[model samples]
Target chain A: MKKQIIYSLKSPYRENLDVIGFTFGSGEKSACIVGSTRGNEVQQMYICSQVVHALKKLERQGEITEGRSIMVVPCINYYSMNIGKRFWTMDNTDINRMFPGYEFGETTQRIADGVFRQVQGFKFGIQLASFYQSGDFLPHVKMMKTEFSQPEKMLEFGLPYALTRKPRPYDTTTLNYNWQIWETQAFSVYSYGTETVDEKASQVSVDAILRFLSAEGIVRANVKPGYVSRIIEENTMQQVHTEHGGIFKTLVKIGDTVYEGQVLGEVYNPLDGEKICEVKADKCGTVFFIYNKPLIMQNSVAYKIVDF
Target chain B: MIQTVAENELSVNEKLKIRKNTYQNGKGKRISIVTGTHGDELEGQFAVWLVGDYIKKNIGCLNGTVDIYPALNPLGIDSITRGIPGFDLDMNRVFPGFSEGTMAECVCNAIVEDIKGSEVCVDIHASNIYLRELPQIRISRDTAESLVPLAKMMNIDFVWVHESATVLRSTLAHSLNSIGTKTLVVELGVGMRINKDLGYQLLNGIINLLYELGMWSEKPDFEVRQPIVSFDGAVGFVNSDASGVFVSDVEFGSEVEKGDVIGRVLNPLTAESEPVKAVCSGLLFTLREYPVVYGGSLIARILSREEEN
Candidate 1:
């Protein structure tokens, strides 16, 4: 059992719209968890659940006195939290887009700077708990080609699949992608996504964290992770593009094994009821990714699968 | 006097005053028409402008008095925002507004005050433009039965009998009804563009409504027809997955059967297409013209389906 205060801080955007952060763990050593970054359901549903989880965890052990710290930002983007929206309701901006952060700026920038400063001091995991409200996104790790240290550390978290890919240069704000600046022992853990509350995903993520702590010698709990599978098969993944414009209905789920020439999805013209393209899997041993839903447009990522 | 509002405010001297045109027939009817609640939506504003021109040319030909607020959310119009500035509020939502509240509320309260005791309240709007909407009057069905017959005089194809709560919060009608005023909402075209046919059709229908309401003596040239569709059965939305450039195959205002191809998604670089089909039969009210969508983002909406009955 561990309990510590990593840092006490206020969101510069509190009076404005902002995300509220409460940290756990203590002293010089620490890890940070972006408990819930994107929120959209009944308002404060996630926050309320997280609070209950915190209370239960703290009560379970007397190892209450600790040397390491943990930061848990339960809710971000207060304005969106109120409206149950994912983006900043004020400017419709994604708060996740403004991470490591700007020192002297608006509410989001200021909050980003403060959070980054606090997290930089810790030596633990960066977990972003998110629920996909509209589209389907698979949970995976992203790293910059220069981030040699973090991706390797991601393995110990015991995720079902660990996608080691280069982070998009445009992703300057997310807490996970921001870790690339400090390569070694600094990485991210992204989870599978869905439109509504898939409690299983939440449990899976929580289980990952508990395992992560024990793996790092912080806890003495032996847990059997349900979806524990290593990505020792394939290394490189490529995005599949359609040749024309149309609606796509996918045949495979994310992370399923796929072969080249297999039917990945189907495309058609809506007005005349014509099947425009038979989107076949191109050069694949596994369907690491596929469009979560239909209504695709020209040049959209229909699938991302790789061969071992 | 001269009073400063927000940073976007025009100095009182810099403001262009709209001179009210007064008219008197043997009888009198006073009405105020409001348009452009959601900034980028401009068809209703254009209709009002066109109608305003007609009234201006024949100021003496009126059977009653009419006032027009062509663009209520001017800031929204400028930024193409769906709501007001400095607040995450919709101008249409804060009807009969609050005195001690945000800027949108203050403006809404003022509008409710101005339109007090008016014979009719017409709030005009443009659809999202992703789908073509038939010109229709949305009447509050549960309790606003009084305004429905008059709405039919507009001769639009559809009369949406949606309940007050069913509509978005803080709308003009919700405010008007709360203040004991009878209101009617008209929708046409899509946001950010001018649909000439729909615009002119709406202009004609509003004139007919005024005539039926006894605001004017001008008899409607065309007979008014109740739409074959009803409100409760007339609204459903269809969403798309893959985010990309949006391309559609259906025409606005066209009728279609179930499983029809109304639109499609395409891959830009490879020149591939993914077609979207209809799940029910009804009028294809609108279509998303621009591309770039997330899964489950709205792509089209069909009128009431039989199953909805």
Candidate 2:
């Protein structure tokens, strides 16, 4: 195991910001994994750390296949993480949006350029990503709808679902889309948590990466096949919205299978405690996302269900 | 007239409001000046205030409508942060936003929709906190043919034409240009603190532009300079080779010859100094305001005249 300084920026007050990457085995550039572009992505960092731990053990046991290399960068925005902020501490710019970045541009853009220059050109790129919304997601591997994206390769992750999403205007600058544009097949693995760490979800994420490595022949080890992964398109998901502004109470959780017209959550008047409306499933599907916030505004998205 | 473009109710008494003030005559060509996209850059706010006040005091002489958005991200300015405090989003990077979106999106939507059809749009800005820059006008290269003449009339020291594609499409100027509103971006001073001289100079520039555009009958009282026009490739940036404290030898807006010593990087522990020099003869439009810099940080931006068009 070798610890490398992928990028560094000098600070006046505090210590210089250094982005560290861990590499195991040495030969062909096989795979690269990035975690926690934002400071609040604790779960993603936890999963990557676990992956690093497992890969170190596998290297000691000589299970890593010869002539293959793998690199793991557990956290990129450590300054923000130290302050409990989500973006770059100085400019509040998101490192994720500045991929293929400008070396002479803003501070965040320089960091992005420095890091991307080191990580680009790998055969496969995996990013431990999180959602923009404050909610839970079922552990899944997501791929952008690009020419380089192949849904068949996602089955190796052994996650329950593999989702293909069309890139939005903002997504074009994301690490996943940029990787695909540069001819490196990119996959974003979304775990169940963002701000907090869920041990079960982290383990599931770490295992999924290991399973993918073994399947790709990067590691010569036997890993459990956890789930019969299903492929789904992003546009097919049904979004459930709230009709009233009130306190939100949901009994159903993410990944729960529900029938049509089933009660999902209830919105109560914030002042009276009386129920304003009850949110229900519109189609027979699996609850892929449940809003975890305690209050819901009118027309806010409360749930997203993937019809089976 | 005062109008609320967007509002967010964080608490009962605490609310975030994006307000716009307008002065109008019967009707002619409409012009909109917007600033305060980033919270830390406060010079634009002061310039807008000065311009807005000038228009208010001279409302009867106005030929067309003038819309001024003094503070777009009030919450950010209140906290002295660059991006919006709660959302952690840059207001400048969410232009032409969706109507049904988050708080920052809604604010962008409101501003874009309000100023979409204006005849002239001016986006004001201050340099980042790390650097101090001269008062200048920046227009995208693609829109240079139509906007350069107006940019030159802004009474600023330099007019820069940069590649539009190199910038993010989400920027207000880029979005406005896409919709046929050729926007001129004015960047001056430094972040956090206002440079009163440049602020008033830019304010006069806006008044001069309004007069040039036939939006106002009265002309600016002050004399404007013959602005030097620069293309994207003509700007030279001096970068540090090592992380250290930078002490600049020249001031912002200083003219330099080829191979002039512009600054030096000093290592406190080693007591070593590396002198930074200019590559060509031109105006130094941007200089490092903050002394501490990383190895890759820009020390100075010299507007070279080798290939000026």
Candidate 3:
């Protein structure tokens, strides 16, 4: 295993910001995994660290395939992470949205350009992604339904579910979308949480990545064939939005099966603690996502259920 | 007359609404003025108020319909956030939206539908708190041929014709232009605070534009400035090389020569200062407003006179 500095920038007030990558084996750049481009994605970063640890052990045991290399970047935007900010601390910009970035552009763009230049040509790309909203997602592998994307390949991760979403206009600037456009099969692994670490969910994500690597012949390890991941389209999920804004009290968690018209959560008046409304499931399905924040806004998505 | 453009029921008893005020005298060309897509950009708030006040006082000057759509993102404006408060979505980035999409998208879609078919539209904005800008109209190259003539009459200091690649396709201006609304994006001042002078300047430009578009019968009182139109590769970006509190020695919108000392990055801990110099000779149209900056923070943007020639 070799620790490589992929990109570095000299900071005036602190140590130089460095984007480090760990490489295992040599020859073909078989895969690249990135985690936590945003600061609040602690779980994403933790999952990537575990992946790196697993890869290091596999390499030491000579389990890594010959003439194949894998690169793991555990975290970017550590400067923001150190300060507990979500985006770039200097400027509130998301590095994830500056893919195929400009060399002469802003700070985030330059960092993106430097990192993309190194990670672009890999055969496969994996990103530990988190949702924009504060929520918990069922562990899954998601792929953008681009022309270059092979959704069937996502099933190889052996997670509980494999999701394919049509790319929106804002998605074109994202790293996962750009990677696929550049001909790399890209996948985003969503764990159970973003800001908080979930040990069980982290292991699920780490095991999924290793299982994929072993299945693809990049690594030779004895691992469980996790699951026959159900193929799901992103738009097909049933969303349950709260009708009132107040304190959200969730009755069901992610992965819980529910019937149509079942009460999933309740919104209570913050001041008086009176029940404002009951959030009911519109369709019978397994809960795929749940808003974890205490305060709920009117019309905010409280839960998303996927019909099996 | 005031009209609701879009509305959504909130979790509380209240409702989130986007509204427009229309002043019409007769059947003629229609012009629309829009602002407050970003809640923190308060410069536009003053312009909206001033324009509405002027139209109400001089109703006789209105030959056609003048639609003032202020606070496009009322939720953001109410919460003082750059994007939608609860959704964390940039309202400007979800343009020409889908009716079946999320709440933000539906609202954007309704706004586009409401503003479409106007002869001309002026979308006003202010720079983020970190930077201050001179009154300017930024038009993408694709729309420049048709819009530059109209932009020249808007009385701004600079008419920046940027490459289409630099323009986000999802922006309100781009969306409106793509659908043939003839929208011009006017950016000026700094975020979160109203600049009376800049606001009045923008109001004058809008009235002049209305007069030029045949939407206003009476002539505008103020003389419009013939802006310095940008040519290819005319804008020079100046970035800071050191991170510290920057103290500017030069005024914004002032002509500067190449290598002129515009600001200095002061490191109080070490008692050291790093001079930030102008990269090219031109009109300094943009300057850093916030004092603290990182190594790569943008200090200023100079519109090169030589390149324009």
Candidate 4:
């Protein structure tokens, strides 16, 4: 196991920003795993760190297969993380959206360019990503519908779901899309939390990565295959929106299975504590997404369910 | 003529009103000048003030109408914030906005709708807080075909033609172009503060553009320098190797050849200095003004006329 500085930038006030990567084995560039691109994505960073810890142990025990290498970049945007910002602190720009960045562009673009250059050339890329909105998601691997998307191989992670998403306009600059454009099959592993680390989901994410490495013959570790991941299309999910803006009280957690028309949450008027509306499930399926913020705005997505 | 484009009630005592000033003599071509899209970029506000005064003094000489929408995001400027204060959203990002959407969206929608049918639109801006920039006119590919020639008539030093596909579609100029308005974005000075000289220079550029477009009967009184017309890819970025106080050796608009040291990143703690060298021969249009910079931060942007193969 070798700890390498994948990229570094000079800072004026504090220490230089360094993107650290952990490598296991010596030869082939088998897989590259990126943790959090945003500072608020603490869960993503924690999960990647756990993966690094496990890979280090596996490498020490000679479990990592010869001539197969894997790289784990725990955190890419540490400068933002230090200040608890979701994007670049200075310009308020998102580094995640500056994929295959211009070297001479803005700060975020340069960071993306430097980081992407290091993570490219791997056979597979996995990004422990989070949603833009504050929410809890059922742990799953998401793949963009690009030319290089390998949906079948993503099931090797053994997560509950392998979601395929169609790219949006803003998604064109994302690392996941650019990774695929560069012919590296990329997958975004979303856990249950972002700002706060969820232990169970983090463990699931670490285990899933180990399971994938083992299944692909990159590592010879005896990790258990977690689940038979179901292939899900992004459009198939049912979004539940709130009708009234008020204080939200969620009754069910993410991953909870619910029957059709079941009460998922209730909104109470802030002025008087009177129940404004009840958010209900319209489909019989597992809860895929749940809004974690205390306040629910009118017409805001409160939950998403994966049809059974 | 001054009229309100958008008005939103913030409180009983205060209301946010986006105003537009029009200068007209006879109907020919309508030109719209927009600024203050981002509250922090105040250089455009000064340019608008100067241009509004110019148009007012010479209103009788104007052959067509000139519409100037200055301070588009009043709520943002009121609090000295970049985005809309409560929404914390960049008004520039929600272009061609929805009429029935949120406050920022409605504001954007109103602005887009009003400026969509203009003969030409010039969106003015200042660099963000961190950098100092030389006055330049930026146009996308589709806009370049029709606006670059007019952009050359402006007094700015650089005219950058970027690929339209690569530019963000949500920007005001992008949305205006989508609706068939030939738009040119003029960015100058720095954010939060205004350079009087650059402000007057860009103001003159707008007047010169108006004169060339036949909106003004007389030639613009300001001197116009031939601008370096370059593609977006012709700009080169110089990044810092070490994290430290960036003490620039050269100022904005400094001309440097390849391998010249533009600045040095000095580590105040270690007292070590790392020199940042220029990779291409061009004029430095952007220089980092805020000294404290992180590794990978753009220290300078050099604009050259070299065509990318």
Winning candidate number (lDDT): 3
Task: Give the per-residue lDDT digits (tens) of candidate 3, residues B1-309.
Answer: 999998876655567889999998878888889999998998999998999999889888878899999899888888888888877677888898877555677788999999999999899999988999999999999999999999999989879998875328889998899999999999999999899999889888888988887878788877899998996599999888777889999998899999999999998788899999999999999999998877678899999979774
Query: What tens digits encode model 2's per-residue C-alpha lDDT throughout A21-45?
Result: 9999989888999999999999899
Question: Best TM-score goes to which candidate?
Answer: 3
Worst 10 residues of 1 chain B by lDDT: B4-13
Rank by DockQ, highest first. 3, 2, 4, 1
What are the DockQ scores of the candidates, in order?
Answer: 0.02, 0.32, 0.42, 0.21
Q: What overall lDDT goes with each candidate model? A: 0.59, 0.84, 0.89, 0.83
lDDT per residue as tens, model 4, B94-153: 787776554556678888988888989989989898888888888877667778788888
Task: Say which prediction, candidate 1 or candidate 3, comes out ahead on DockQ.
Answer: 3
Docking class of 1: incorrect
- Candidate 1 deviant stretches above 4 angstroms: A1-308, B1-27, B166-169, B223-225, B269-273, B304-309
For model 1, residues A1-308, the per-residue Cα lDDT tens digits are: 23333323231223333344455445645566655544453222343345336534753663323675555655554456566666654335455657776654433555566666656656654645443222444555444444344455556677766655444333444666565464324545555552255665555666666566667755444467645545532235555765445567787876687777888888777556688777777676666666554455544457767664
Model 2 iRMS: 4.2
Per model, the share of native interface contacts recovered reads: 0.00, 0.10, 0.31, 0.27
Query: Model 3, range A56-90, lDDT digits (tens) per residue?
Result: 89999999999999999988889989999888887
- Which lDDT tens digits does candidate 1 get at residues B1-309? 112221221211132122223334445777777787787788887788777876667655667777777767777787888776434455664665654333344556666777777788788888764545678777766544687776777768777677554324456776776666777788876768997877677777777877777765667677666654466656666666443456777776777788888777766666766677786797766566545543344677678456332
Superposition TM-score, candidate 1 onto the true structure: 0.52
